[model samples]
Target: MSDHRWSPRSPVAALARFVGVPFDAQTYRNLAYLLLAFPLGIAYFTVVTTGLSTGLGLLVTFAGVPIVLATLVVTLGISSFERRLADHLLDVEVDGDDGGIELAFGSVEEAIGTTKRVLTAPAAWTGLLLVGLKFVYGVVAFTALVTAFAVSATLLAAPALYDAPGVTYTFGPYVVDTLGEAVAGGGLGVLLVLVSLHVTNGVARFGGFLTDALLGGAARSAEAADA
Candidate 1:
């Protein structure tokens, strides 16, 4: 078997890998995932919070039982979708049997059994937690990515914009006015973009990990059985 460790032959090879992050397909996928996280997170959070609050609030009435069950079913469905999304965009394998819950109208006993199973399932609770926290995760990711890309783009455009009338480009303590200074600022911008791509990849990996842990029902069950 060939060794595939991070044993680059030279400093130049290591630097090439670092600089080549933007060209990688996975990096773009990570960017897409992060970009989508904000809106999707908000949607998930809204649905989950509304369902849970409404269902629990009305639990005194007979309608509350069905509502809560329906909410759990919907949450599980969302979890399944998130798992698939992580698999597609982050290239993470989410392996496990999703305990399928089907409410049978024909038999009350079957319906009650299904309800019990869903209520006691570890996956259900974990999935709920994941959905609830998605809003915060989305906001952080969206803000970070937008800020990083915006700053990088601004710096990269400094070379062309610095000389324009009534325009001043400043990078911290240094002001970009001359062509040489603008060029240097542009170079720094390129470096920042590369760094941002790497950071984005790292963030995507963390998201994938969170999804796998919360949604991998079979894996969790197997570990519990082993214990």
Candidate 2:
């Protein structure tokens, strides 16, 4: 109880938070980040993977060094964008902090030097891996969030539609043909929606961790700034 990491401030408070769901600011912010993750994931996967493969292929001919460097530079830039996204949306620090992410290469010479550093950096590779994984998780998360919301909306509206002729909704082989059943379904919908908020929070935490581990902590913040 004393340690928030080990347990919630209070069991009751945790339950209340679960019930309150995504109505609050943090949850909404998490939801927004989740929605954006899919597209960003797609972009990350496409660019990084392409750059890696292209650079690797050209390596044999000595033509690949530049491509590899370019890829690293691009990924580094993308990582910076991801850091900004996490800092802005997720509950984390990315730039202008003790351990933050700030990658800005201004000159050709600077880019060349930065690229060399980025290639050998484990954080850069790890960050690329995280970016690739984000696409997969983002798809699943987006679907779940949308499904939860849709179900909640439909069930909440059931009672209003119950009086309509030939109106009936089925839930797991249970037909909601009466006002009472409709209302009950609506209540269930509410519960599911609340649960989904926690899911959104979990996903946001993951994104934040990835940003912190890979894109953050100022690898070249000072150098890039001076560049």
Candidate 3:
């Protein structure tokens, strides 16, 4: 009788299949953008909320007019920065529609028109809303990423430290103390670490998709081909 069994060609091949993130470069690039989201989200939320509040609170005062105007101007600058960031990092073409916001350069008239446009454009406010909510996404991503990495690290290191003093491993009610148990736990750890990498990559891709939707406008909608 012949034995029938299936196994991976090699350890590296197994890991590669498990960490099935397409295009390693793209994955890393997405990860880079996701990593920046946390800090950027914080700054965006702080500045925009504070500026809007101050402007509204002081609306009755003579000083309120200029402050409100200045706040809008500052937000226009922030919107420009975000546009550049989305374009460069996500590689999404943000073609504007009627409600789209854009900054023009030329005469003083053009500059004033740009300022007026920024103040009136609905997309500008929409972008601000997106920015304000981005901190929540950042928090969730940061927490998930950190937790996955920590779990992977702890699992991988469990075997080596199992024999060390004051070291204990427990699964439910059973304690892991024997060498056999340690070996089995280590093997499981290796598999989970690969899975964790995939999870991290997935989070990055989701973040990119969301930002693309928020900023890409019609260009993003262009994904659906004509019948």
- lDDT against the true structure, per candidate, is 0.83, 0.73, 0.66
Q: Which candidate wins on lDDT?
A: 1
Clashes of each: 0, 1, 0
Tell me each candidate's TM-score: 0.89, 0.76, 0.71
- For TM-score, candidate 2 versus 3, the one ahead is 2
* Model 2 whole-model lDDT (C-alpha atoms): 0.73
Report the backbone clash tally of model 3: 0
92-201: candidate 1 lDDT, tens digit per residue: 98866554556575688988888997787666778788876777888999999989989899889998999898877777777888998888879989999999999999
Per-residue lDDT over 134-174 for candidate 3, one digit per residue giving the tens place of the 0 to 100 score: 88977787777788767667667768887888767775476
Cα-lDDT of candidate 3: 0.66
Candidate 2 at residue 8, lDDT?
61
Off by over 4 Å in 2: 1-15, 94-115, 216-227
Candidates arranged by lDDT, highest first: 1, 2, 3
Candidate 1, poorest ten consecutive residues by summed lDDT: 96-105
Clash list (residue pairs), candidate 3? none
How much RMSD separates candidate 2 from the native structure?
5.9
